[model samples]
Structures are given as C-alpha cells and as structure tokens.
Target: MSRRLRLLFTALALAALLWLLFAAAERALALAQRFLALPEWLQWTLGSVLLVFAAAGLSVLWWLLRPRRRRRPLPVPDRSSLEQRIGQLRERGADTGALAAELGELDRRRVSARVYVALFGEISTGKSSLIRALAPHAQVASDARGGTTREVGHYDGAFPDGRTLVLADVPGSREAGGEAHETLACEEALRAHAVIYLCAGDLNRSQADELRWLADFGKPLLLVLNKADQWTAVERDKLLARLTQQSRGIASAVLAISAGGSERYQRQLADGSTESVERQRKPAIEPLLQALDRLTAPGAEGLENRRENAVLAGLHQRTGTLEARTRAEEAERIVRKYARRAIVGALAAVAPGSDLVIQGVLATGLTRALAELYGVKVSDVQIEDFVQQAKLTLRTGSSIVLAVAGNALKAFPGLGTLGGGVLHAFAYALIFDSMGRALAASLAERQSLDQDDASARLKELLADAGGTRLRQLAALTIDAVRDRVD
Candidate 1:
C-alpha cells in the first residue's frame, strides 16, 4: 500500500480499538454499581487503568496515522542545452542577409563622409531656395506664404566620384512649430556626408535651435548666410563676422550667398559689371564638398567589407534565435500534453473498482507508483493508465493464486474463511507488484514520447530559420543559396 493509505488504515484500526475499550469500561462500571460489594477504591483503580490504556492506544495511533509530509520536486536545470541553442542561433544569424543590407547602406555612405545642413532663420530665409540652388532637381513644395513648407524636406545627390551629399530644408524657423521642423531638418543634414546650414542675414532663437541641432550630428558642416542681397556690403560683413565667430568651433566653412542675385554675382568683372549672368555661383557648396572628399579617402575599402559582413551576420543571427526559441517552447508544450494524456489513461483503468474500499487502496498505490516512475506529479492519473494497471494487476493476481493452490489447500484442509483471507492478502500483494511494473513501462513510454516531440519541434524550427535566412540572402546578395535548397 502507498504510505498515505497505510496510515489511513492504521487510523481506522485505532478508532475501532478505542470504541471497544469505551464499551468495556462502561459495562464494568455498571457491574460494580449493581454489586455494591466491591470497594470504591478498587472500582476507581480499574476505571483509571482502562482510561490510561485507551490514551496510550490513541497516542500510538496518532503517531502512526499522521499524514506523510511530501517534499517539493527539485528544479531541473537545462542550461547547457539552452546555451548551445543560443550559440547555434548566433552562428546562423551571422550569415543572414539582413545584416548584409545594413552593412551595404553603411558602406555606400562611408563612415567618415558626412554632412549637416539645416534650412532655417527668419520668416523668409529662402531655405527652400537654398536647397533648390544646391540640387536643382530636389523638389521642395513652396509658395509666397511663410508656412508653405510645414514639414522637413530631405534630398540626396551624388558627385562625380560617387560621394553622396544630403540636404534638408525647413520653411520658416521663427515660429515654435517651424523651429521644430527646422530642428528635424538640421538632424537630417547632420547625418549626411557633410552639413550645409542655411540662414538669412540675421539670427533668431529658431535659427539658434537649428544650429544647436546641427552641432549634435558632429559631422563636417558649412554655414551659408543666405539672402545677402538684403544687407549692404559693410553691414553684411559685420553680421557675417559675428555669426562666423559664434559658429567658429562648428562650421568647416562659412560664406555669404545672394539667393536672388547669385547668378549675376558670380559673373562680376573688376568694373562691377556682370559678364556671365546665366552661370550660378555655388560659394558654400564647393568648400563643403572638399571637406567630405578628405574624410572618406582613408577607410573606404575596409568600411565596404565590414558593412557587407555585418549585414549578413545580423540577419542570420536573428532568424536562428527566433527559430530556436519557438521550437523550445513548442517542445515544452507537446511534452506537457503527452504526460497529461498518459496520466488520464491510467486513471480510467482503475475507475470501475472505485466503489470497493480496497480498490481505493489499490488506486492510491498505483497512482503513487506511476507518479514516481514517470516523474509526473499530477493530482489524478488518466482512466487509460488505470485500465492498463488493473488488467496487469488482475492477471498477476490470478497467476499467484494458481501457483500457490496446493500449499493453500494443504494449510486450510478445506475452503473456509481463514483460507479465503490468506488468499486475498496474497492476491493483493501480487497485484501491487504487477502495478509497479506497469507504471514503470508507462513512464518509459512517456519519456520516449517526450524525446520524439522535442526532436520534431527542433527540426521544424531549424527548417523555418533556414528558409527565412535563404529568402533574405537572396534578396540582398548576388550569390545566395536557392529557395529549393533552403
């Protein structure tokens, strides 16, 4: 019997003994009262002895019948497996295409080649006009009103040597909202190969924010004081000096530009007469380009190679990690479900004999044995497990009876109560032994199922990861593995 059932039977036996003692004491007291001959001291002594015996019996029963305290299951650590899975995922992601795309973008831009340009300052700083001047094809939506360009506009252009330049325009930098747009524009400029900061001949709070944002990009930048036509030469020069000094630590170059008269200004002869009015003067942009050329020259080759490898590595790692985690979770779920089903089957096998008191003992023993053997601690076993356990128990019980028939008949002399009791106990022992064996087999089956489920989940996970990695590689590289192969 299981420990719990054994304790329960002990309790019932003690209770029956207690009842018998109480009845005998009451009868002795009645007999003493009727006789009136026995000494009061003798009768009292007899009652006290009986009471003491009852108490001792009760105490012994309590010790024997007290419930067994079950210990908590130990936590199983599977860290080695987990770490191995992580390492595999990292290796896979290293060869995927997402990493390649990221690297490719970085390579094209070149790490040190960057520019920051912000279109800002005053109600009509001609920020849009400045962008148009730099890249004629860059379309910035504009009108006569101040708020015509509420959003930031960004454009990129390539020079003859494949070096790229980015430009950004913010419509008006004076208003609070306009200042925010200018800041965004400045940020975009900062991320470029170099920076071109646009401003009217004057400075404002919004213009200051734009400049501050530009400083954050930390790249080479040029400051363009636009609309220089609005100020006289001396006044413009004085303001330009002050602005230049304010931006001394930041700007690589600072120049004055007349957005309206830029074409004519470039063609001025010594007599102050325009010779070639059609040619545009790009005073600020030329210096900005020169700075970018110097920065990108040193690490061009190394940067290209690293960018390509990093992109592939990143994609491969992500795909593998996702697949591994998914498979692990799936394996855990499948194993849990399989265990539950096995337990349910066990419970169903023993349900028919549930009405018999001894059946409860058998059920309890069989359940405990199954739990121990299978490493399952469920509250109840499945009906199927119970049915299988019962069949084995019955078969073993019959075999034992047959084997001991001659000895049993010889001891009893004939079929009687004593013989029947002996046979029942022997059969119970045999049945318990059979149940133990059946539980062991069931547990083995469960473990096999768990292993199989884990293997299947792992395969599915790897397949998915491989497929995703293949697709991404195909998208980003010239020599990727084919989809069919993946």
Candidate 2:
C-alpha cells in the first residue's frame, strides 16, 4: 500500500473506535435513567449496597500493598538483665574501647529494646548513602573520599512495626594505617542485632575475604549491591549473579539499590532567569530496609548467642594486642641492657682484637638475657653455640662493611680511637638489637629455624638497619658515653 493511504486508513479506524465507545456510554446512561424512574427508596438502597462492596475491595488492596516486614512484639526486659551482662564484661577483662561500647549499647537495648543494625564495608563503598536512603531523616556523617569517618556514626530510625532502631555507619577498614579504625568497626558489628555489608559494585579477593571474616561472627548479614542507578540492566544482572554466587553460605540475603544520585535539572525563576540545579534522586532502599527489619525483629533465632560471641571475640582481640605489645617492649629493654654494656667495652678496647673479644662475650650474655625476656631458658652450652655461630656470621658478612664505614670516619680531625670506638659501639648495639628481635619472634612461634634460615633472617635485619638508623643509634650512644665519662 502507499504511505498516504496507509496513514488515512489508520486514522479512520481510530475515529470509528472512539465513536463506538461514546455510543456505549450513551446506552449506559439511558439504562441509569430508567432505574432513576423507579421508587426513590429502592434506588437509594441499591446505590448504598454497591458503595459498600467498593470500599471492601479497596481495603483489601491497601493491606496487600503495605510493607511486608512482620515482627513479633517485643516483651519488657528485666532491669537487672543488662546490668548483669555489664558485670560479666568487667570480670572477663574486656577492657578495650570497642568492648566498652558494646557493653554500653547492649545496656541501652535492654532498657529500651532497640534493634541496632550496623553497615560495614571498605572505604567509598556507599555505606552512608545506604543509611540516608533507608532513613531520609537520618543524621549520618559521610564523605566521598576515604578515611573521613574516623568514628562510628549513630542514626535513629523506626521500622514498619513502630519498633525503634539505631542504625550505625561503620567506617571503612583493612587498609594500611587503618587497623585501629577497622578494629572499632568489627566491635560495632558484633554488638549489632544485624549487619549490612555494603558494596559499590564487584568484590575483589581482599574484600571477599573480609566479608567472609565478618560473616563468621554469626550475626545476620544482608549483602547490599549499591549504586544500581549507575549500571546498565545487563551489567547489573551479571554483577548481581557473581555477588550472589560469592555470598552462597555467608550472607543471608543480597539486594541491589540506588540510595541516592545526582540529576541535572533546570529551573526558571519569577524574574525570568533560568538556573541549573543538581537534584538528588530519592533512594530506592525500601526493600533493603524491610529485610533488615525482618532480621532484627523479636524472637529472631540465635540472637542471644550472637551478642555473647561478639563480646568474647572483641575481648580476645584486645588481649592479643596487649600481649604482643608487652613482648615487644620487653625485647627492647633486653637489647638496651646488653647494648649499653657492649658500648662501655667498645670504648675500653686498646687493640682491634680486644674489641672483637669483648663483643663475643657480650653476644653470649645477650643470648641468655633475651631468652629470659621471652620466658625461655637457654643452657650454657646452647648460649656458647649461639655465640659462636653469631660471631662467625658477623665476621664473615659484616666485618668489611663496618671497617670500611668506620675508617671513613677516621678522617675527621680530633677523633682518633674515640671515633672508631663510637662506630664499634653503634655496630654492636645494632647487631644485638636485630638478634634480640629475631629471637623474640622465634620464641613466640614456639619453633626453631635451621642455621641457614636464621643466618639469612639476620642478614635481612641488618640490611633493614639502613644508614639513617645507624646515625640515630650512634648519636644516642655518644650521649651515653659522655655520661659514663662524667
């Protein structure tokens, strides 16, 4: 058919369809007019009955469309129940800031029965956006860059059941110089009634590992695939499938959403001026919020055990940190004790061999002292063997390096044997410090390394003590020398 004929035929079909619809309405009105001619009382009764059925149908639809989160009512908790838990924390030596907060939050829950849900993930993972989207009135501290959230952010919200909630925004963790902050987030996650692990898009190996670690705590977790607005339908589906496969046994649920995003818009003013505006789109977080409500509701499974394990886990982490730090400090003290005496002996050396002999004796003594610092006992024969091996390693690997370095300093006027003595003292302390640290490590591991492995590790330690560390130690020893001379 020709193009003009085809369009004319289509227009005529549309006009015929409209005329038929008007004719049907005219017939319906005529039937209504006939009913109006009946008795007024019968007409009124029929109209009221139809209105009642319409209201019933509308009510059913509204109930079906409401949010589906159904939670059992919470009971009144005993006043003393939370207090008893606080006392237990004290008795168990839960003495870190994170543990302290857990106790405090638990106590609050007991008094008011509020469910705490925390969001945790790596930096720039849309955690804050998720929170704001879930609660538009939410007061959250968020930034676009990493490391802005130095502390946990607390925001209040309510669920569909009118139950209160405390939504916590956990800062990103697991980066260099971010251990302390990450530890705090872990503690927060433990005490929360439920956890939401937020992700910007895909999960790499490190992020996946961290997610597994968090899931191991046994809290209810919902893995959120955020920023859905930024992805195409096909791309989003592919990523969603990958994440859901990755979360197989860990996360209870996975959801995708766009909390908020910027859209460019133009507005005209009353004075005829036009302005550009960057408006934020309303968040699509209703589904995620409903899921959280279901997880934290009263009578949830394993809720009590989850809270207890979290507290105990935080306590264990804190205790381990304290023990490791104590060991390091004690190792430092042992190194300084022997290194000071080695310095005095180095100053007293009148011949080259004399200084070497004094340092070998000091090495043996240092070996026993460091073992004691590590809560180990070394026999005389073992100390002798360690001294011999250490002396051999030092003579073979480091003798030329130190002599060349010391001889270079001899060119300084007015510094005769004293200059050489300073270099020797610095070298002795540096070597002793390295050995003490290595021994502490081996003792901590409760294992022994072969001679070759030990020697290679010693070489690594010495290489790490670069020229800057050498100069710092030398300056410190010079002050000690002056004090001894006085």
Candidate 3:
C-alpha cells in the first residue's frame, strides 16, 4: 500500500475511537442530570445501590488474589519417646550408637545456652569465606577447590549487639563422590538454632529441594546469594527477584552479599621482577548481619524447643532406616533355613512327582516366622489363604522351575549320580526360596501380608534363570544330597 493510504486508514481509526468515547460520555451525563432532577429520597436510594454493588465487586477481587499463609510442619516425636525407641533398636542388635550420640549432643547444646547458626549450601558457593567474614578473629580455611572443607567446624563468634553465637562451618554439598560429607552437612544443619543457605546465583532443582527440606524442619532460615560482585545492579535485582519467587514460603528471608574471599595478583618488585601476592578481600555483609540479628533475637533459650524438635526428627528417620535394614537381614536368614528344609523334605518323599507340592505345615511355619519378624500379625486363616494362592502360582510356573532345575543338574554333573531325586530336591529349593523372598519383600514394603502382591512377586522369582542364582542353588542341593547319603 501507498504511504498516503496507510496514513488515511490510521486517521480514520483514531476518529472512530474518539466518536465512540464522546457518545458514551454524552449518554452518562444525560442519565446523571435526569437522576439529579428526581426527588431527594429516590436519588439517595439509587446512589446507595450503586455503592453496594461496587463494594461487593472489590471484595470479590481481593479474595481471588489474596496470598496464602505458610502451612505448619509436622510435629516431631517427644524426647522421651525417641529415647525409648533408640533403646528398642539397641536391644534388636542394631548399631544405635550414632542415634544415641545425637540425643546426647542435643542435651549438651541445651545446657551450653549458645545460639548456633549453620552455614549450608553446595560446593564452591563460598561457605568457608562467609564463615571467615562472620567470625573475623577465627582462622577458617578458604580454598578455591570444591569441597575443601570436609568436616563440621564450630567457631565462637558474637553479634554486633554483643550476644554470643556459635557459627558452624559445614562441608559443602553436591560434590562428586561426597555423599558422606553431604550427610554430615545435613545433620549439622538440623542441630543449629538457624541456618544460612548460601548460593552464588539462582537455584537449580537440587538446591531448591535442599532448601525446602530444611524449611520443612521448621528452622529459621535465610537464603543468601554470595559472590554478588559479579552481577550488575539491574542483574542483581532481577536475580534476587527470581530467588524470592523460587523460595517464597521456604526461606524466611533472601539476601545477597559478597563474602569477600581472598584474591591473588601478580605484583611488580623494585627490580621489575613479577611476584604472586595474595590478600584477603574486603567483605560487605551488612544485610546478612541485620537479617541474622532479627532472626536470632530470640536467644538460644527461647529457641531451644525448635532446635530440639529438628534434632529429634532427624534421629527418628535415621533410626527407622537402621531398623528396616536389620529386619531385612534377619528375614533373609529365615528364608534360607526354610529353603533348606524344603530340599530335605522333597528328597525324603517316597513317591516320585513331576509337579511341585508346597508342604502345607512347613509353608505355614515359614510365613508365621517372617510375619513375627516384621511385626505383622496374621491369623491362621490368612496364612492358609496365602499358601493356597502360592500353590496356584506354582501350578502355572512349575514347568519353568523344573526346567531350571534340570539345567542345574546338567551344569553340575556330580548331582546326576546322586539319583532321580536330585532334580526334585533342587526344584523344591527353587520354589521355597522364591516363596520366602516374595513374602518377605511384600511384608517389608506393605507392612502386611498382601496376597496379590506377594503372589505376583513369587511368579517373577520362579521364572528368573539368572546364572548366579542357579549356581547358588546347585551348590545348596549338592550339600543337601551329600549329607543325606552320608
């Protein structure tokens, strides 16, 4: 199109918009004039109705856009109950020393009456530098290498207000092959009165997850962005805005500062020979200082309950893990014993059989023993039902079991000389091992005897023809046959 035509179209559009505005204004004025001409009482009634409608609309808008309050974290178990659980775990032969030590440390901190603040974040985020900045007099090692601080170190420091504080410098998390150090850092975070989570920039998925986990513990937390000197003012503002949105309910406050880690530079001597010189960078952490001051205003005594709760919650999780592991080991031992007994029973049977028969009494005994170990109460009827389900599964997979047993016999030639009973013995071993493992796994996961899940697992285990399992079963059958002949 020509320039002239384009200009004409734009002018016409503007003119149309102006005409519409003028007509609307004229109509509103006419309505207002007629209303003012009415009786005073009628005019007042109309105005009141308009005001009520406007107020209602405004209230609805506010309700739709309101910010939600943070939800409360789950309550941790009390100290006495936690101690009792630790004692129970110890009685069960689990190594509960670490859990007991955590409780002891909790008591010691309560008596010390010092506010503890832990510095926690990923590697190379300047956690060590921040510690040095916060406690100037204390000697802290700040290296350029990632994961340089490998343990938890406590330094005595004081706030500007003269309140004593103990700052813990913990190992940075997310280092390659640093899982043990990461666990150390997390445990120390739970022990402190508050935590300072440092980052050099916006958080990734892992950092956000770590932040939320700490927040769920109900700790007074501050998300600090270190190495702020790298970004421009506008960039810093935008980064802080994004960090704030990412950590809305999780962190109590988010701020940025330069921890002022040391810097090295080449200097010229009098003879023009260049030499490397290192010096400590000046720290700018006033905002961090102010936030800590407001956050820790309630001294160690005032915040003792929250600190104690966090510690106990951590111990509860660790103890539960140890309990599960111990139970699994014991369950395996029971499974082996039952499998061996099944092998002997199969060999002792006078009648030769092609199909698998689950010895009813022995099956029930194995199920009950595993149930008792896992603390699952099962009735006699339930045990019978579970055994029946297993029989049906075995009927379908028995051919597969016998085929695996035949292969085992061929693999170990010496078993063939034992007799025709050797194949049946190995088949019984496979069947009982599969049944016990499936039942144990289902009980451990569901904490109950789930017939359907256990049955499905049993079918899979029967069909599995892995080499290592076959070898182990071959060895077990050999030992059983040799003992029977002797």
> Highest lDDT among the candidates is held by which one?
3
lDDT, candidate 3, residue 468? Answer: 87
lDDT of 2 by residue, 77-106 (tens): 333554454455456444445535655766
Per-candidate TM equals 0.32, 0.66, 0.83
- Per residue, candidate 3 scores C-alpha lDDT tens digits across 368-483 of 99999999999999999999999889888879999988877887767766767888889988988899999999999999999999999999999998888878878888888889
Pairs in steric clash, model 2:
none
* Local error of candidate 2 at residue 55 (angstroms): 68
Candidate 1, residues 1-486, lDDT tens digits: the string is: 899999999999999999999999999899867756767887788878989999999999999877544222222224344345455545644333432343345445665454423454555656666666666788778654653567666776555577665655655555555657644443334334444566766666656655654454344456777777668989988988988766766666677775542343356688887665575454345543454456445434433343333333333344445654544444333333333332223233445543244445444654554454344654444533554445544544455434443243344333324434333333333233334333444444464223233233322322232333323222322111122125
**In model 3, which regions exceed 4 Å deviation?**
1-68, 142-144, 264-279, 351-358
Cα deviation of 180, candidate 2, in Å:
6.2
Model 1: C-alpha RMSD to truth?
A: 34.5
Identify the leading candidate in terms of TM-score. Answer: 3
